[model samples]
Target: MKNMKISRRKMLIRSACLTIGSLFIPISYATAVNGNRHLSKGLDLIHKVLSRPLDVSISHLNKCLSSGKIDLENHEGFKDYINSLITVFNGHHHGEDEILFPTFEEKIKGADFSKLKKQHKEIHPIAEKIKDKINVTDPSFDNYEEIRNLLQKMNDLWIEHRDEEEGIVELDMEPLISSKEQIELNDKLSKHGRDMSEPANLILPFLIYNLEGSDRDTFTDDMPWILKNFVVPIIWKSKWEKMKPFLLA
Candidate 1:
C-alpha cells in the first residue's frame, strides 16, 4: 500500500511539472516542438506584396523634374516612365470614381462627385495631348521644342488638379468613403505584424537616387518602412541591353 501511494505521488508530480512547463513555454517553441507550421510566419511576404511603391516613385520623379538635376543617362531605362505615371494616375482616379466615389456620393448627397468626374474629363484631354507629344520624342529623337511646351503645361495643370482633388474633393469625401479607416483595416489585413525590410529596400533606393544631403536623410528617417522586402534577387547587369534605338526619330 505504501509503495503504491509513493508511485502515484511521483506520477502526479511529473504530470504537474509537464503542465506547468507547457504553460510557461512560448508559442513559437510549442509550435516547433509539435512540428507544426506557424500561420503567422509569412505575414511579411503579404505585406511586401500589398505595399504601394508607385506613390514614392511618382514623388521622386516630380522632385527630379523640379530640381532639373536628373541623370538622364542613368534613367534611360525609364523611357516608359511618363506613360506609366499617367496610366497609374488615371487608373487611381478611375478607382475612386467607380468604387470610392459612388458610395461616398450616396452618403453625402450635396457632395460634388459629378463635378469631380467632370474635372477628370476636362483634365484628361490636356494630359492626353501632352502624353501624345512625349511619346513621339524617343531616344534617338529629341523634339525639344514641342516636348518642352507640353511638359511645362502638363506640370502646371497637374499641380492644380492635384491640389484641388487632394485638398477639396478628398477632404470632403473623408466621412463618406472613410478612406483613412479603410486604409488602416487594409494595412492590418496586409500583415499580422510590421515588416522591417522595406525601409531599406524600395524607399531608401528611391530617396537616395532622387534626394541629396539633409532632404534625403529626412525622407529616409521619416519613412522607414517604404520597402520592407524588396530584395532584388535578379540583377540586370548589362546597360547596353536596356538601351534601345528610337527608329521613329
Candidate 2:
C-alpha cells in the first residue's frame, strides 16, 4: 500500500514537471512537435529564392558601376543574368498578387492582406521600370545611375515587405494554418508563377544555382526528376555559362 502511494505521488510529480517544463518551450517549437511545421520554414526558402538572385545582381551591378566592368567583357552574359534575377523576383510577386493573396483571403478567416496587396501594386511598377531599362540597357551602354537608384528603391521596399510578410506568416498564419495546408497552397502558388513568368533555362538555373547546402538539397529533392536529371545539366547549363562569374553555384 505504501509503494502504491509512492507510485501515485511519482506520477503526479512527473505530470507536474512536464506541465512546468512546457512553459519554457517556445510556442513554435511546441507546435512543431505537435506536427504542424511553421509556415515560415517553407516561406523563408521562397523568400530567398525570390530575393537572392536580385541581391547578387545588385551586387554585380554595383561592382560594374564602380569599376567599369560594364564597359568591359563585351556585355557577355551580364544582361541575361540580370534578367533572370528580376524575372524570378517578378514571378514570385505575381503569384502572390494574383493567386496566393486571393486564396488566403478566401480560405483564412480574418486574413486581410489588402496592405500586402497594395505593396505588390507599388512594387511591381518599380520592377517593371527596371525591366524596361534592362531591355534597353547593357554593359556597354546605358545609364548606370538610373538603374542603381531604382534598385536601391526596390531594395528598400522589398526588405520591408519581405519582413512584413514573414512576420505575418510566422505570427498570424502559422498558428492558423497547418504544414499540409501551406504545402498545398504553395503548390497552387508555384503553378501560377510557372504559368505566368518563366522559362526553365533562366528561372531554374538561377534558382537552383543560387541555393546551397540544405536548402539546395531540400528544394532540389522537390523538383521534377527530369529537371533534376536532364534539362538542367544537358540543356541549360551551357546556356548560362557566360554568367558564371555572377552565379553562386
- Encode model 2's per-residue lDDT on 1-249: one tens digit a residue: 999999999778545533332222111111121256535765677677767766766776787778855644624566667677677676677767776677677888889898888887887788778776766534343565567778788888888899999998788867777678776766666556555444455566666667788876665654556555665655456666777776776
Flag clash pairs in model 1. Answer: 197-228, 198-227, 198-228
lDDT of 1 by residue, 1-249 (tens): 999999999778545533332222110101111122111221111112112223333454555556655535634544444443344345434555654456556666776667667766776776576467555434222343444455555556555555565555434554344444445432332231112112122222222233344433332232223221221111111212222221100
Error of 2 at 249 (Å): 1.8
The C-alpha TM-scores of every prediction are 0.45, 0.77
The CA lDDT of each predicted structure is 0.38, 0.65
TM-score of candidate 1 relative to the true fold: 0.45
Superposed by TM-score, candidate 2 places the C-alpha of residue 125 at a distance from the truth, in angstroms, of 1.1
Model 1: residues with Cα > 4 Å off, grouped in runs: 1-75, 136-142, 176-181, 184-229, 232-249
